[model samples]
Target: MLWAHGSRVSRLPKDRCSGITPPDKMPTRAPWQALSVVLILLWGHPRATLACPHPCACYVPSEVHCTFRSLASVPAGISKHVERINLGFNSIQALSETSFAGLTKLELLMIHGNDIPSIPDGALRDLTSLQVFKFSYNKLRVITGQTLQGLWNLMRLHVDHNKIEFIHPQAFSGLTSLRLVHLEGNMLQQLHPATFSTFSFLDYFRLSTVRHLYLAENRMRTLPAGMLQNMPLLENLYLHGNPWSCDCEMRWFLEWDAKSKGKNSQCDSWMPSPYRSGNIPFSSMPVLLCLGSA
Candidate 1:
């Protein structure tokens, strides 16, 4: 016999059941009724077992998925155990300091296709365990230094398809474990030397773990010498679709491209050595006219 939720439920011993009980000795319907009550009391209360948030589905373990909600802000009352949060295709404009404060177990955060114009400081300070963060297709213009602080364990970041024009030098300072960074399809005009370098004990060092760097479809003309130095693990570098200035200043980049041995590093506007001396290659360059003028 076992007592469940103040209800005494009787159980027959295995030795007493030899295979089948005689019709006269069989249990009555009253005992079966008691067993039904015990079963209902044990599994009837679903709210007590898992408190899933409204407009969101929380599956076993920890995963919250909410999309196309048109939510103007981060949904409140999210369970702390949620590991992944998909809030894409919403109307969120900005992120406050306390938007995602207590979610220490968060790993993947996708907030793409929103109207976020800017990211305030400490907006993601509490997401320490975050690994992949996607903020693509937003209206962001600039990335400040403190916008992504405290994300030490972050690995992949996707901020492409935005109108980003400027990135603070220290925007990616604390992201030591970052591996892939996607900044394509933006309006970036230049990159500072310290934009990707960090000060170490005695000298500056770039993120060595960064393997893939996507900077295509931007407005950049040239990169300063040693701007991408010390990235020993860098493999895939996408620098195409930009108006590359094939001048003396791009000697380092051209040399590096030639030495890449077809390792998926792309660049354009490279003239042969014979034509480098005041010779212009008009046939090799592609022209793009304005929208109204021919």
Candidate 2:
């Protein structure tokens, strides 16, 4: 009889044991076979044995946490099944085209808390399934055309807290599904009319899907006439902390903005009169409390 303790016992009586096999004569499992069985039970499942990268944490198969690692570039050996990648709190300076090349299933990519100065063309070319792209708290100075081209499914873009000075006329032309844009805390001097011209599309009539625009804390002097005419779905516009020149050139904008969206636009201060009026000093522009509309 096979005992539960891995030992064999004789079940036959002594009189019948003449033809019965002895307990010690039974076949025994080899030591290596028992060890192999133990190894198979420990590592037989792929998920239980998948190795995570060094200095990084992969608590699950779909999420990776590589924060505060001081990584200079994108790390390798990340499983392609990963859906969310958090690379925040690093010293990554530049992003090349192949940085995220094979990460097809990546959905949420967080590269904030870095020192990226400029984003090259096709830098984010492979993130087709990416929905949220954050590049905040960087040293980006300019946003040229094609700098943000291949993001079709992008919804929320946070480019705030940078030194962006000049945005190319067609910099934001390809964000068709974009809903929120945060451009506050930058050095934007002017917002060209063509900057948002490509955002309009034909649904039944011309329409825009952009809902919120945050341009606060910049150096905007005056906005072009009819700049927000195409944004049919615009709900909130934050334009405070800018030196707005309130004059005859702003008459149409003021009237249109006031009538279009009641109290949606705002500004810090406005000049009561036109600039260079009788060689008037720029400091003479009155600082009055007026919403930045029109």
Candidate 3:
């Protein structure tokens, strides 16, 4: 007689073995085998887990923790009821259209702390409900018009600390809801003139704002004198800690900035401003754009 413990015993007397016919005669399951089969069906499979809960899974119901997981690639779909998905601290290199296949209801997706060099085309095409998109601390060096397509509802974007060198002029055309952008630390050496030509609702005023406008740590040695003609609403300009070559090229900034101002034409000209005091003009304190004394 075969028992469920992986062992078998000899048949007993006829009284005990009454039901024991040939091995293939009856349905062939012993009493223990019947119980074993029932137990197998009762218990589910083993517990296997992905790095985090799918956005459609348990995350939408509440705040989910997907931090510090070493996931190299993304799995398939998420749960239909999930909402906030945090997938930070991974080695994710690229973003494909197939990565996030079914997260339609996802709102906040924290994809910071990864190795993403650049976002691919249509990476986030159908996620209609995405709100806050975070992609900080990566190796991203470029931004294209197609880098951000389907995130029509995105509000706050944090791509501050990265290796971004420049943004395609049309990159911000489709992002209508962008209020404040943080691009403090980057490799942005310069900006393109056609930058805001396609700005959907973005203010057309500050032309420098398109350069991530960080002049404090400017890598550019000189400012194109006449480039400021197109921008008018510039309130604050930081040109500190930069190597500036005082010459006629920057003279355009003086001439064009004066012409761009449609209001109060007498306050001060970009040429006679205080930014030029210590750098070039030592006689006065009018914010003049000049060569740094030090």
- On TM-score, the candidate that comes out on top is 1
Candidate 2 TM-score to native:
0.72
**Per-residue lDDT value at 208 in model 1:** 50
Worst 10-residue lDDT window, candidate 2: 280-289
Badly placed stretches (over 4 Å) of model 3 are 1-63, 194-294
Tell me how candidate 1 scores on lDDT: 0.76
TM-score of each predicted structure versus truth: 0.72, 0.72, 0.56
Better of 1 and 2 by lDDT: 1
lDDT of 1 by residue, 6-34 (tens): 46566656665567667788789998999
Question: Model 3, 58-115: lDDT tens per residue?
Answer: 4324445567667676644444444677778888787777777566776888888999
Q: Pick the candidate with the highest lDDT.
A: 1
**Number of backbone collisions per candidate:** 0, 4, 18
Name model 1 segments beyond 4 Å from true. Answer: 1-50, 202-207, 263-294
- Quick one: ranking by TM-score, best first? 1, 2, 3
Task: Pick the winner on TM-score between candidates 1 and 2.
Answer: 1
* Residue 47 of model 1, lDDT score: 41
All candidates: CA RMSD in angstroms? 11.3, 7.4, 12.1
Task: Summarize candidate 2's per-residue lDDT along 107-224 as a digit string, tens digits.
Answer: 8888888999988887777777788888888889998888777777778888899999999867767677878888999999997765754464452233456788888889987888
